[model samples]
Target chain A: MAKISMIVNGNPVNANVDPRTLLVQFLRENLRLTGTHVGCDTSQCGACVVHLDGRAVKSCTTLAVMADGHEVKTIEGLAADGAPLHPMQEAFREHHGLQCGFCTPGMIMTAVDLVHRKGHELSDEVIREELEGNLCRCTGYQNIVASIAAGAKAMAKSDLA
Target chain B: MYEFKYHRPGTVRQAANLLVKNEDAKLIAGGHTLVPVMKQRLASPPHLVDLSHIEGLDTIEMKGRSLVIGATAKHAEVANSAVVGEAIPALAELAGLIGDPAVRHRGTIGGSLANNDPTADYPAAVLALGATIVTNKRRLKAEEYFQGLFSTALEADEIITKVMFPVPKKAAYVKFRNQASRYALVGVFVAKRPSDVRVAVTGAGSDGVFRVTAFEDALKKRFSHKVLDGIAVSADGLNSDLHGSAEYRAHLIGVLTRRAVEAANAKD
Candidate 1:
């Protein structure tokens, strides 16, 4: 076992874990930050998406040791303390972006990252293309795409305020 | 995943030394490929020499006529790099078309080339662009480096330090991806230099990424999609699976090659 320390959702977490423990497992099992789902253990499903050092990456494929000394932002980290909801999260709720909601956390996380990187002017084509990793069995992508666009606009507006 | 000792080396020398010391150790850059395989029990290295801490191995710069990308540079870095965009726009575009954004953030060019997954995007670009694979021990041409699928000419203890790609006069890559896995069902990369033209195909090769000499010869003569009008790609030695038959892939090789050529020409 190796001792690893990282900043997760604004908190510094230190734990001793097996070298093979994935970042998703570390987040869900050790830290108890279960908002980051694990729909597919393989790297295909972006259900384990999270921000490592400000860049979105698949947590399921990342080893806990690999994230040592890095900052990880999960679905639980999006909202501020005592805040109602993150702009992206609110947009998803407003747009009805989810059906069964299994893929919501990952989708919202990924959308936030996309907006953070690509800005608010993302075209529908770009959103669909960028969403190639995250899969929703409920086939609720139409609303998800709308939610991301709305979320990006709201975030951009907030960035100016 | 199985138990393994993880070693984070601060320098290329330290990483190479660790590799030499451990008999069944594997060098990990981004861990995008290795980790998945480990989780599936396809690979069970007793030790993992993580190279993420190695300094100077993730730099992207232009040195003379070549664009040099350090081994640990992630796909997202390359996709968004100003240097890569200015020097090799096609390379940047290719990087962007790699796995999704999440995978792009964690997958590195060195890891991709070293793993040499038959359906990978980089191999076609490397081979077509005639890039050089630089290692701690020595530098090798792409042709001399890739041996076969999931294979390279790298020695057991060697570590890829960087890759040097000459700025092509014109180049483009077009891929038909497997919608589910996002891997290429058939991808073609075309590069046109002042002196010669090169075309490489990935995902469709049964053995691995291979160049299309016939297509190259035809493109060299005309440098246009029209030149490949009736060119036939033999189905022999091509991959045939549920996604596409060998004949279908053979047909795509011709079609994508034309598309790549047209795209390259438009860019130029």
Candidate 2:
């Protein structure tokens, strides 16, 4: 077993985990943070997407030990308590960005990171390009990109307000 | 994935020692490719030595006329690196063009090259740039490195420390990407290094990435698209998949090579 410490959802969490435990497995199984879903078990699916030190990464491909000392933000930590859904989540809901909720959390997490990095000016082409790794079989991706753009504008407005 | 002992060695030397000491060990950098294979039960090793914590393996530095990219440098780092953009813009574009943003954040150049998937993008860049693969033991030229499909000259436990790509006069990567997975269906890298021109094609050939000698010679003489019109590459030894036939890949190699050259020569 490997003793690992890292900032998880803005809280410092430590645990004794098998060295071979994947970050997705550790988060979903051990920590009981089942908000992050497992889609393909391969990195190809974005169902296990999360923020590692503020950047999007497929948690399924990352080992728990590799995440030690780093900050991890799973889908569970996206919105603050008593606060409305994070702008991205709200946008997804408004835009009907989901058919099944299986890929929603991961898509929102990845979209949030994309908007944070690329900002609101991103074109549909750019969004599609950025989302090449993330597979969304349900929405056809138009709504997903729209949701991201809407979320970006909302986040910007919130900041200005 | 089958259960295995995992070691996250903080230092490169420690990681190398662990790999060497273990009889059935594989180095896992980003795990973007390895983990997937492991999960499929395609590759099962007794130990996996994770190399993420090692310091100095994530750097991108300029050395003389070349760019020195640390082995563990992520695709995102390379795509956003000013050094890579200024020195070799094609490399930056290629890095940006790799499998989506999530894969870019976690995938490493070393892991990609070491994995050497036949359809991978980095092989074309490394071969076209005439780069050097600097290992713990020795440096290998790109021509001497790639042997065949899913094959490389690297011995077990010989950890790659850095990849050195000399600044080419001009370079560009044009890929016919697989629509869903985004793996290159047929990708070509065109580069002019000093007076010499190199054309390397990936995804198309059964031999993996290889230079187009005919295109290289023509480009060497004229260095333009018209010069490549007369050249004909045989369909033999090219890859055929559901995406394309061998002939289609052969044809694409020519088309992408020309486009890449034109893109390279286009004004910034």
Candidate 3:
């Protein structure tokens, strides 16, 4: 077992985990931050997306040791303490970006990272193309695309304020 | 995933020494490919030498006429790098088309080339652009490096330190991606130099990424899509899977090559 420490959702977390433990498993099982889902274990379904050192990566494929000394932001980290929903979260709620909600956390995390990188000027084509990793079994991704576009604008507006 | 002794080496020399010391150790760069395989229990290396902590192994810069990308540089870094964009726009574009954003942030060029997945995009670019694979021990031309699918000429203890890509006069890559996985179903990379032209195909080969000499000959004569009008690719030695037949892949080789040539010409 290797002792690993990282800042997760603004909190410094330390754990002694088996070297084989994946980041997603550490987040869900050890840290109890279960908002990061694991729909496809093979790293395809993007259901376990998270921000490591401000870049979005598949948590299911990342080893816990790999994330040592890094900052991890999960779905649970999006909103502030007793604050209103994040702009992206609000946009998802407003646009009804999800149905069964299985892929929402990952989708929202990925959208936030996309907006963080490309800003509010992301085109519909680019949004769709950027979303190749995340899969949605329902809603046909029409609302998800709409949600992200609106979310990008809201994020930019929030950044200004 | 099986338990293994993980070593985080701070330097390339330390990493190389660790590799030599451990008989069944595997190097992990980005862990995008190795982790997935390990999770599936396909590979059970007794020790893992993680190279993420090695300093100076992730730099991207232009040295003279070549763009040098350190081994551990992630796909996202390559895709968004200004140096790569200015020196080799096609390489940056190809990096952007790899896996998805998440995968791009974690997948490294060295890992991709070392793994040499037959469906990978970098092999086609490396081969077509005539890049050099720089290992800790020595530097090898791309042609001398890639041996076959999931194979390279790398020695057991050797580690790739960086890749030096020669700036092409003009180049472009066009890929037909698998709808589900985003891996190339058939991808073609075309590079046109002042004196020579190179064309490489990936994903459709049964053995691995291979060059299309016929397309190269035609492009050498005249670097235009029109030159490939009468060219044909055989189905033999091509991959046939649930996604596409060998014959279909053969046909796509010709079509994508033509498209790549047209794109390269337009970029010129």
Q: Write the per-residue lDDT of candidate 1 for residues A1-161, one digit (tens) a residue.
A: 89999999889999999999999999999988899999898988888999999888899999999999999999889887677788888899999999888888899889988988888888889999889989998855999999988988998867421
Give model 1's DockQ, 2 decimals: 0.88
Candidate 1 residue lDDT tens string, B1-268: 8899999989999998998999989999899999989999999999999998888899999999999999999999999999999998999999999999999999999999999999999999999999999999999999999999899999999999999999999999999988667789999999997789999999999999999999999989989999998889999999989998999999999999999999999985
Ranking of predictions according to TM-score: 3, 1, 2
- Displacement of the residue A57 alpha carbon in candidate 2, Å: 0.7
Cα TM-score per model: 0.98, 0.97, 0.98
Off by over 4 Å in 3: A159-161
Worst 10 residues of 1 chain B by lDDT: B175-184
Query: Global CA lDDT of candidate 3, please?
Result: 0.93
Q: Which ten residues in a row have the lowest lDDT in candidate 2 chain B?
A: B175-184
Clashing pairs in 1: none
Q: What do the candidate models score in CA lDDT, each in turn?
A: 0.92, 0.89, 0.93
Better of 2 and 3 by lDDT: 3
CA RMSD of each candidate after superposition: 1.3, 1.6, 1.2
Runs of candidate 1 exceeding 4 Å displacement: A159-161
- Chain A TM value for model 2: 0.94
Q: Clashes in model 3: which pairs?
A: none
Q: iRMS for model 3?
A: 0.6
